[model samples]
Target chain A: MVDDNTLLERRNVVKKIVDHRGNAKIITGLGSPTYDVFDAGDSHSNFYLWGGMGGTAMIGLGLAMSIPDTPIIVITGDGEQLMGLGSLASIGVQKPNNLAIVVLDNGHFGETGMQKSHTSYGINLCKIAEASKFEFFFDVVSNNDLENLIEILPPVKGPIFANIRIKSQNPPRKLPILDGVELKNRFRKNLGVEPL
Target chain B: MKVDDIQNNWEEKLFSLLLDHKIDFLPYVPDAGHAKLIALAEKNKLLKPVVLTSEEEGVAFASGSWLGNKKSVLLMQSSGVGNCINMLSILSKCNFPFVTLITMRGEFGEFNSWQIPMGQATKKTLEAMGIIVHRATHPSDVCPLVDAALYGAFSSDQQIALLLSQRLIGKKKW
Candidate 1:
């Protein structure tokens, strides 16, 4: 059990996730997930969602299937994941080997005034993913677990899922380029793809 | 059913057109009307056929495929169109190319009362999301409308919907 005071910080966890990403295209769910990814560091590869709530992981699936050689990671929050719960089963069926989803389970909707979310009330995301057929799902509780994840993450054949319990606290907003077209163009251009 | 109700080979024609347009990813929720087309798409080695958990997932799936330099067309029934409303924002905001073929219900010979509301509202709902709506009530109308839609989407980044009228598909026996 993760103690309240000792839970891994959201900011640090996001940073570690980004640090080990290794040329993967990252998609963030709305609100804090976007902020967390932006706060980690901006990149041409990061597709930050200012509004699409549950679409992040599905985006990773599509991109992973499109460019099979490139890795795709989606970093989202518990609330957004809950909203798009069906996507887990969808992605599991397709089973893209290069796609991974990392959920920062802060147990509340941090952006919407910290309303208690389903994960706080015992909605187990890892079990859900396992049932959905994710072969490499982990509930990351400690730094050691995160380190173990980091070492295996980039090269691991996924449909991988990781739910990390973090402190439910608001960090300073690190907004990325809010222009959706600009973000889309930059992300595509980064992959040598002309803007569509 | 009309004298010309049984249209021959339209699904095959549409699938060939998709291949001609270089659409490589096909994300769909199962619908009986789309079975033949989905099968043809699955047979293509270059095409990736993704079965979405729900309709909303396909919208973002198409957007992401576009972001990664691939083309995708979403297929769903009118009932699922309601599910895709919010997710279509991903296409509108990013101006991603979208082309969807919707097999309509609650239009001509619908027996299912539960399918009524969203089925009746499908075109308007899509229009509200800034998508251009086209309906093919007959077999001859489908490929031409979809050909234009493919051009409209990929060539100019437009969101286009091709609704296959339930009449053309024949009413469900049940």
Candidate 2:
């Protein structure tokens, strides 16, 4: 269980996770997850979702299934995850070994104004994921747990779900390329696919 | 031949056409109309079939598969099309190649009144989302239309919908 006062910083956690990323493709959910990913330094491998709120995990699943040799991670928020709760079941059924989902849970919907989210009201995402039959489930709260998560992330056979409890502080936004076409082209180009 | 046997044959042909087009990902929400196709995909090793919780996930799944330099197709009923509208915008805006095969309800002696609204609107709604729509009212028309949709989607990076009329799939017994 995470103490309300000792929450992790979203940006720092994002930076640590992304810094260790090697040849791994990333898909970020809307709002803070996108901002945190961009703040970590942009990459052509990163597909940032500007408006598709609940579609992040499915996109990750598709990518993982298509390119089974590559590692794919979906970084999203609790609000976004809740909106597409059914995706967890789908992912569990597929059980893609190359896919990982990291939820930066701040217990609030930061984008729609910091209103209390379902996580704040005792909705345990880890339990839902476990029930959905995720291979690994972790409720990350401390720096040591984050370190363990980073170490195990790359080689971890998933679908793994990790919920990192974050603070309710709004960080300065670092927006990435919002042009959908450009983002798509760059991501494809990185994968050595010719753009249409 | 019995009607069910004839329908199964057509479904097998459709599956083979999809395989011929190199569609590696098959994401769908379960529908009775798509049962034959779904079962074929599940047993085939080459096809990576995923059972989506909702129709919108299939949209995202196809888009992501395309991003990974692979081709994918979505299978859903007409009623589920409404759930995919907003997510479909992502495909059109990005000009990502997308192809969906829809089994239509509420057309040609539809018994359920609930299916009529979405069934009638499926074509217009898809067109409004910038998807080129094609309909097949007979089993003979299914292959060629699906082939055309696959070609247009991959070659021109266009979103295409292939709607299979209820008249072809047969009306629900209930």
Candidate 3:
């Protein structure tokens, strides 16, 4: 379990990660991760899941498989990740080299009035990823660990899973475009595809 | 062709149709009825066959595939259709094109009481969720309906559910 004292602020960590992201398509999980990614700087390439709680990781897998040469990252919260934990096993089996999943472990369901989550009690997401056979697994707790993750995430040749311990603080909501069609078309246009 | 050979040919034909439409991502939950199609997808070097843990993930995977300008198709059984209701909302709301080939169970079957409820509800449930349901009860109808579903999904950006009836795939022998 991650010690609370060693946790980093979610926004700062997200910013650092996004800053280092070089031409990688990002899929953000619902709630905080979506806000965090938008806080970093909105891009046409960022596909925010405004409501799909458990489907984020597989979406990243699909994107990774579709565009094999490009990097794909899924940034989600612990609660959301737990809801779709089965995705880890599926991802492990496919073994997509261009995919990475980063979990912001605040140990609570921030979307639901700060209710305690499984990670807060004893659920170890990094261990779960390891057991699922992720090529790289990191339980990040400090600045140096975060830096190491940012360095290794983009170019990693296999599925990489990282659970970064984050402080539990409710930042003001930063909502992106809620219309799914518009979001899809913009993302497609960014990929140089004609919008349907 | 022999009787058994003809049955296998239909499955291969469906696979070829998907390939013709440029579906590079194949996400599926294992179903006996789809075994031949799944096997063909696995052996194809150009297609990325993903084994999904649940039926719902296939929806998201297909959505992501489309967002990246690639096409995908999901394969599951009738029972698995129940697991996809909530996720189907994402497809409808987002106007994302979804194509899933479902194998019917519990219909025209002599066993497995548990599969009956979902089997009966599959078509209505998909319809309620605003998906266009297409069923193929005979071997000859398989390729054409699948072709239409694929065209509707991609060209019109519609959610299409292609249900393969038990009569077409043959009843499981107990």
Q: Name the best candidate (by DockQ).
A: 2
Q: Which digits, one per residue and each the tens of the lDDT, describe model 1 over residues A51-151?
A: 87888888888888889899888999999999999999998898888889999999999988999999888889999999999879889988998997887
> Looking at candidate 3, what is the lDDT of residue B128?
96
Clash count per candidate = 0, 0, 0
Ranking by DockQ, best first?
2, 1, 3
Put down candidate 3 lDDT per residue, B98-158, tens digits, no spaces. 8999999879753788899999999999999999999998988989998998898999898
Q: Local error of candidate 2 at A3, Å? A: 4.5
lDDT digits (tens) for residues B63-114 of candidate 2: 8898898998999999998998889989977888999999998889887898
Question: What lDDT score is found at residue B71 in candidate 2?
Answer: 91
Candidate 2 stretches greater than 4 Å from native: A1-3, B1-8
Q: Let me know the DockQ for model 3.
A: 0.77
Q: How does chain B score by TM in each prediction?
A: 0.95, 0.95, 0.95
lDDT by residue (A1-196, candidate 2, tens digit) is 4676798899999999999888789999999999999999899999999876799999998999888888998999999999889999999898888888999999999988999999999999999999988888889999988988887676348888999999988899999987998999999999888886
Residue pairs in clash, model 2: none
Q: Give me the runs in candidate 3 sitting further than 4 Å from their true place.
A: A1-5, B1-8
